[model samples]
Target chain A: MALIEVEKHEVEEEQKPEPVRVRGLPFFPHFLLREVVVMCLIAGGLIMLASIYPAGLLKPADPFDTPSPIYPEWYFLYVFGFLKFWTWDLGPIPAKMIGVTVPMVLWYGLLILVPFIDRNPSSDIRKRKVAVTLGVIVLIGILYFTYFSIVHH
Target chain B: MTLNDKIYKWLDDRFKLSELLPPIVKHPAPLNVVSNPLYCLGGTAFLCFLILVITGIFLAMYYKPTPAEAYKSVEHIMTAVPMGSLIRSVHHWAANTMIAAVMLHMMRIYFMGAYKKPRELNWVVGISLLLITTTFGFSGYLLPWDQLAFWATKIGTGIAGSIPVIGGYISLILVGGNDIGAETLTRFFAIHVMILPIAIATLLGLHFMMVRIQGISGRL
Candidate 1:
C-alpha cells in the first residue's frame, strides 16, 4: 500500500507542465502578413484584370495559312525548343510527341511515386544534392536547348 | 438581474467571443500560423493569388480584349492611362514571377517530403491546380492579342489537338472550330473569366482543407 502511494506521487510530479520550445506561432518562425498579403493580391488581381480583353474573334482556322514558326507559351519554351530537331522536316511528328508527351509522362510518374522513392524525411532539399542537382541540371539543359533553338532560327 | 442570471450572462458572452475570435487566442502570429509544412505550400500559393488579384484589377481598367481594340487598348493604357506602363510591366513581370514561384513551391513540397502518405491526394489536386494555373496563363497570354500572344496561342491550341482521346473535340472547343475566330476568342474568354476561375477557387479551397487537417509534416 505504501509503495502504491509513492508511485502515485511520482506520477503527479511528472504531470507538471513542461516548457515547450515555441514562441509566437507554432508553425511560422517569423510571420509577415503584409508581404504575404501583397503577394496574394498581386497574383489574384493579375488574373482577374487580364481576364477582360482578348482579340474578340479569331479568323477561321485555316490549314493552308499556317501560323509560321508556331511556338508554345514562354514557360513551355524549354520543351517546345525540341521542335527544331524535326524542323529539318524530317521527323516533326516524333519530335513533337517527344517534346511534349515524354516529359509530361516522366514527370507525372516521378511525382506519383516520389513519396515511396524519397524515404528519408529531410527539410533541406539541397542536402539531397544528387537528386536536386540532377533536377537543376535537367532544367538548365532544357532552358539551354530553348535558347539554342531560338538563336539558330 | 439576479446573481445567478448575471453569472450565466457573463459566461455566455465570454464563450461567444472565444468562439468568434479563436485565432487571436490560438495564433497571434501570422508566420507561426503559415509556417506549418503542410499549410506553407498552399498558404504561399494563396499569397500569390492575392498578388494576382491586385495587379489584375489595376490592369483591368485599361484592358480591352477585342482584336481591333486589343493592341489599341493596350496602347491607350500605356500612353493615356496614369501609370499605365507600370501597371502593364508589373502585370507581365508578376505573371512570370507567379509561375516561377509556384514551381518552386511544388519543388519545396517535393523535397521537404510533404507530399507523402495521406497527402498524396492533395498532391494530385495540387497538380491539377498547377495545370489550371498554366492554362490561365496561356489564355491570358492571348488576351493581349499581340503578334507574340496570337501566334503562341495558335500553336498552343494546335498542340491540344495531338492528345489521343478527345483531342479533336478539345481543339474545336478551344478555337470554336479548327480555325481561330470570334467564337474561339469568346470561348477562351469564357474559360479564362468564368469557368477556370471558379474551378481554381474550388480546388484551392479543398486543397487548403486537406493541408490544415493533415498538419505540417516533420522536418528532418
Candidate 2:
C-alpha cells in the first residue's frame, strides 16, 4: 500500500509543470559589479577620513588621577545612561545590579529571543504592526539613552 | 593557447575548476537585492572588517602589549614609523565604521522581518557577531594605555562587575586582576588580536555558509 502511494506521488510529480526560476542577475559580473563599486566608495571614504582626521593619542595613563567625565565607547554609552537613569531598588535586587543586568544581559537576551517571540510568519511591514512598533520603541529608547549619557557626561 | 588559457587549463586539469566554476559563476542573486542599496549594509561591515584586519596586522607589528611600553609604542607608531599614523588612523576609523555598519545591518534585518522562521538561527549568529564586534572595540580601546583608555576601561569594568551573580567572574576574567594593569593589557591584547578574531572568523564562515545554503530571505 505504501509503495503504491509512493509510486502515485511520483507519477503526480512527473505530470506537474516545471518550476519557474527566480528572476535575477547572475552572480558573476552583473552582481559583482555593484559590489565592487560599493566597496570602492567605502574604501575611498575611509582613506579620506583617515587623512583628514587621524586617530588621537592622549596623555599616558595615571592610575592615581582619575579623569572626570570619563565614558565608555559610544556603543556602550546607552548602558552607562541606563545605569544612571535606573535608581530605584526592586525588593531585594539592588538598583545597580538591575541597571547592569537590564542593559547588558536582559537586552541581549530579548534580542536573541526576537525570532522566537514574534511568530507572526509575515515579512510585510504593514502586516507586522506589533513587531514594528516594539522595534521602533526599542530603537528610540536606545537613542534617547545614548543622548542622555552624552549630555550628563 | 595564450598564457591565460594555458594557466586555466593546467589548473582545471589539476583541480577540476571547469566543473566547480559554473555553479558559483552562474548563481543568480535576486533582482531586488541587486538593485537595492539596503542589502549592502552587511557587505559594508565585511569590507570594514577586511580593512581592519589588514591595518591591524601592521599596527600589531609595532604594538607593545605591556602596560609600561604600550603608550610609548603607540606614540612611536604614530610619530616615528613610516605611514604608521595613516595605518593606525585607518584601523581606528574602520573599527568604528564596522560597528556602525553592524548596528545598521541589524536594524535593516529587524525592520524588514528578515529574521523570520527559517532564518532564526542565522539571526542568533548575527547577534553573536554583534556582541563579538563590540567586545572587539572594548578590548582594543584599552591598548593605547592613555588616560582616556585607562579611565574608560575602569568604569567599563566597574559596570560589568556590578551585575548580579556572575559579574565578579566576568570582571576578573576580563581584567585578569583586581584592576586594569599589565595582566589586563595582555589579556585584552590576546582577546583583541587573537581569540576574538578566531571566533568571529568561524562565526562569519558559518553565517555566510548558512546564507548560501538558505539563500537570501525573499521578502522586501
Candidate 3:
C-alpha cells in the first residue's frame, strides 16, 4: 500500500511542473519592440532596393519567337538542373521521368518524412551526428544544382 | 473613472476581457528566441508576405489578365500609374525575399530538429507553405506575359507535363487547352490572385495556431 502511494506521489510530482514555461520577457512590449525594429529595417532595405533596381519589363510575348537560354525562377533552378544532370534511364523508365520524379516528388517526400524518419528524440546538435551530416549533404546538393542550372543556362 | 477605465469595464462586462486579457498579455516569449537573429527568419518571411499583399493589390487594381492586354497593362502599371513603379518593384523584391527567408527558416528548423516529437504536423504544414510560396512565384512569373515570362513558363509547364501518368492531365488543367493562350493567362492570374492567397492564409493560420499550442522549440 505504501509503495503504491509513493508511486502515485512521484507521478504527481513529474506532472506538476510545465517544462516549457520558462520565465522570459513579456511578449507584448519587450519582444514586439525588437520585432518592430527588425521589421522597419527590412522594410527600409526593400524600399531602397526597389528604388535602386526597379523591376524590368521585357518585350511582349511572341509565340513564333522563342527566346534562347530560357530559365524558370531562381527557386526552381534545381529542377531544371537535376533534369539536365540525370540523363540515364533506369531500365524501362525514361530519363525525363526519373529526373522529374526524383527532385519534385522524392525530395519533398523525404522532407515531409523527416521527423518520422529520424526517430531520434534528441534536439541537441552534438548528439544528432547523422541527421546533421545528411542535412549538410542535402543543402550542398541543392546549392550545387542551383549553381549548375545557372552556369549551364 | 477615466474614459479608458469606463471602456474596459463595459467591454469586460459583455466579453469577459478581464479574464481573457491577463494570460495573453503576460505570455512570455523565450529569451533566447527574442535575442537570436536566426529566429527572425519566419517573421521576415511574414513581413514580406504582408508587403507583397499590399503591393499585389495595388498592381492587380490595374492589371489585365488577357494576353492581348496583359503586357500592356503591366507596362501601364510601371510607367503610367502613380507610384506604380515603386509598388511593382517592391512586390518583386518582397516575393524574392520571402522565398529566401522561408528557405533559411526551414534550414534553421531542420538543424535544430524543431520538427521532432509533437511538432511534426507543423513541419508538414510548413513544407506545404514552402510549396505554396514557390507556386506563388511560378504563377506570378507568367503574369507580365513578356518574352521571358512566356518562354520560362513554357519550359516550366513542359517540365511539369513530363511527369509520367498524371503529367498530361496536370498540364492540360494548367494550360486549359493545347497551347498557352488567353486561357492560360487568365487561369494563372486567378491562381496567383485567388486560389493561392486563400490556401496560404488558411495554412498560415493553422501553422501559427500549432506553434502557439506547442510553443517555440527554442532549444539549441
Candidate 3 chain A minimal-lDDT segment of 10 residues: A1-10
TM-score of chain B of each: 0.82, 0.98, 0.97
Lowest-scoring 10 consecutive residues by lDDT in candidate 1 chain B? Answer: B24-33
Error of 3 at A57 (Å): 0.7
lDDT of 3 by residue, B1-220 (tens): 9999999999999999989986776677776786689999999999999999999999999999999999999999999999999999999999999999999999999999999989999999999999999999999999999999999998888888998788899899889998999999999999999999999999999999999899999679
lDDT of 1 by residue, B1-220 (tens): 9998888679878787547554433432323343454445455556666556676777766776566676677777666887766567556655666676677777767656568677878888887788788888888877766666677777777766765466678788788876665676677767877788789889989987896688655553
Enumerate the candidates' DockQ scores in order. Answer: 0.19, 0.51, 0.50
lDDT of 1 at B128: 78
A71-103 in candidate 3: lDDT tens per residue? 788899999999988899999999989999888
Off by over 4 Å in 1: A1-72, A85-95, A105-113, A116-141, B1-15, B23-25, B28-45
Model 2: per-residue lDDT, tens digit, B11-81? Answer: 99999999999778777787778768899999999999999999999999999999889999999999999
Compared with the true structure, model 1 gives a TM-score of 0.70
| Model 2, position B191: C-alpha lDDT score | 98
Error of 3 at B165 (Å): 1.3
- Native contacts present in each candidate (fraction): 0.21, 0.90, 0.86
Model 1 / residue B120 / CA error / Å: 1.2
Clashing pairs in 3: none
In candidate 2 the C-alpha lDDT for residue B169 amounts to 95
DockQ, computed on Cα atoms, for candidate 1: 0.19
